[model samples]
Target: MEHTGVVHKIIVAGIGPGNPDYLVPAACKAIAGAKALVGGRRALAQYAASDGAGQHIMAVTRDIEAVMAFIQEELHERDVVVMVSGDPGYYSLLDAIKRKFPSECIRVIPGISAMQLAFARMNLPWHDARLVSFHGRQPERSALLYQKGAVMGMLTDAKFTSRTIPLILMECGWPGEAKLHICTRLSYDDEKVVTIRLREAENYPEAKNGILLVEG
Candidate 1:
């Protein structure tokens, strides 16, 4: 009974950005060997990700409970891989994964974040940058962007877009001279990056989803 009680670990692999080229070997290995796979549609779309051996748990806000239940049932059977976008450390599903499963039963494999890629695309260093997300969230902490020297990388959704973020910052007193880099569809063939001043954001093209970098 003691031998039978040993449960297989749940592997949480971070699938970087949108490109398969950024996937790390360890993450690929985990996905390839998974007996059960759980993640967003994009994450689960990998060729050998599910392999028809187990269930597909869609990692959406509405299906969270069902996803957890699916994972719990599969965790003890064999390899179970949970994929997340970017690194598990950032604004990803890692937090929910931790809440649903104990530390001992979970293992995280890191991958590149869009923020990291955005900074890279700008040919700038990001270790000193301030990162935040406005995706499906309110910009309540606008005060955090008040700093005079710190660079900022904001994840914007359709609602809080590149056009509005700059205005929001200016309303909060972030000066008009600050440089804004709109990095859209990063790592894709159609990926675009444009630089402008914070004041110019209103005139910039609308961005559905991407990072808006604020540099001093």
Candidate 2:
């Protein structure tokens, strides 16, 4: 619990989906001043400039142990900043890092999560909604949650997206009559929001870094 002289604490910051406007000032400042940056390939590309004068660790498909070791090494040399998509605390790598480091030796900077942006764009109230992410797990769970009429909000992957999600729902005996909202590339210039039913979504194209909102 005591973190004296532990200036090498891990800093987990969310950089939002893609829009710089949604990036918190504190997160931006941290990235701007960081001496080392660690994140997935997508996150690295979003904040490419941060690697100009710092060590950049692309954690694409790397094991969690590798990520933790990378962070540990960075902390020994300079101030390290781990950039994550959306809020770091939202099904991100922050938890794993925290488990390896003491709470007092970590700083978290929150950014606008994709779930919040998705609901906001749809003008829907999410207080009563259920949110889930298929980022690092099976998408089947999202389908099951959607069937329960929880106004499901999900972070989809390339392998499991709007196209595949609906198919899974149908196979799981979902009502098949719910409204589907595919919010893709949120907060970016190429943002797209497609509305369709469960059946129609089965044929929709897969999108990366997108959110699926299901309403009955």
Candidate 3:
């Protein structure tokens, strides 16, 4: 839907692991020109300028309706940018945003996802990797994938942290001798990456955000 002659815009920008260096040029420019910024407190603090002139809205809840209303209200006046960590198209709020707003009203900018970086860090090509988001999802796998000797890249949240994921996989019939690579806080100052057997992953400490590279 058009906003009459106002021509307001909504940008769904991916900020990339909350690291300034990982911020793409387009995303950086979008934040600089944003009249209103919508994101979590940590993301805003990390990428946004301290003295920039923009109304910052904290989007901590899963209330898509509330976020949409705020964006629409802000768009009526000027352009609004919705900041999201990692790639917006990958298990992010992009789908909900698109559902709430019209195509003409939105612009999406991609960023380096942790999964992509994990593959890079491991010096592996990810063209054949099976991508999965275990965030807010129960661990499940297809029997066909198991038969094809697939490489899986999984995005992890608190509930499915690095340490607990291997246990879940073991229960799902995964072998204990499989190769497991855990990458946490990619591109950040305290980033950590470790390679271990699936059996050893149970003792590894968990991180708030991480990726698991599993090869069977």
Candidate 4:
């Protein structure tokens, strides 16, 4: 048989908000079939222990160019699964993947986002919410969202922890009396969700893995 190169494929999979139960069946199936997997170290840790044995897994390098290069090289032989922490489309790896690979060569499998879960916990509708990401950046536009009276949903990281959000809003002249709905370490054993005044948030102890629901 004359040898022709394999038609490499990539599945941009969202594994959900740090819980195995939240992982969709389709994503599980795609991951099981992948020859190579790529994502953040934490996300890979969760998947590697459960569904990633026998697959070549790679962590996203600090230099995005390196990560992209690895994927490009691997895709020449087999399919690669890029695991994103939440919904891949929301403030996630989707943009980078799309830029490197053509849309026709990639398939996206959606997962439950932390924002969706946080809203569900509050029993509030998010259709009208203004979504923002303070993952690695400051919440500069958050003030505008507050001024417009937009119900806001935000994804936060170590830099913009739960405690810091209130401080930023306070600096932005947001009223300290307004209520903040915060969900921290969601879907984990230590998950906590509470609605408290903006002023109270300044003293909160646990500030990691936080999602914020701020009423504008």
Q: How do all models score by TM-score?
A: 0.90, 0.82, 0.89, 0.87
Cα lDDT tens digits, model 3, 1-216, are 445554788888998876788889999999887778888878877756677654556564677778878887888778889888889989888888787777787899998888888999999899988788788886556631453376888888888887887887777777888899989878988888989998988776665468999888
Please give the lDDT score for candidate 2. 0.78
Clashing pairs in 1: none
Stretches of candidate 3 off by over 4 Å are 1-6, 52-58, 143-145, 206-208
lDDT of each: 0.81, 0.78, 0.80, 0.80
Across 1-216, the per-residue lDDT of candidate 4 in tens digits comes to 112443777889999888889999999988767779898998777666464466787898678888888788888778889999779888877898788777767889999899999999898899987787788876565443456465778788887878887788777766788778989878889888999888888787747657998875
lDDT score at residue 65, model 4, on the 0-100 scale:
83
Q: Give the TM-score (vs. native) of candidate 4.
A: 0.87
TM-score, predicted candidate 3 vs. hidden true structure: 0.89
Best-to-worst ranking by TM-score:
1, 3, 4, 2
Misplaced by over 4 Å in model 4 are 1-6, 49-54, 147-149, 171-173
- Cα lDDT of candidate 3 equals 0.80
Per-model clash counts, in order, read 0, 0, 0, 0
lDDT digits (tens) for residues 1-216 of candidate 2: 233567776788899877889999999988777767787787677665743763566464559887777777677677678888789878878878777888877899998898999999999999988777666577445346434556878888877778876777666665678888999889989889988887777566676658998886
If both were scored by TM-score, which would come out higher, candidate 1 or candidate 2?
Answer: 1
Indicate which candidate wins on TM-score.
1
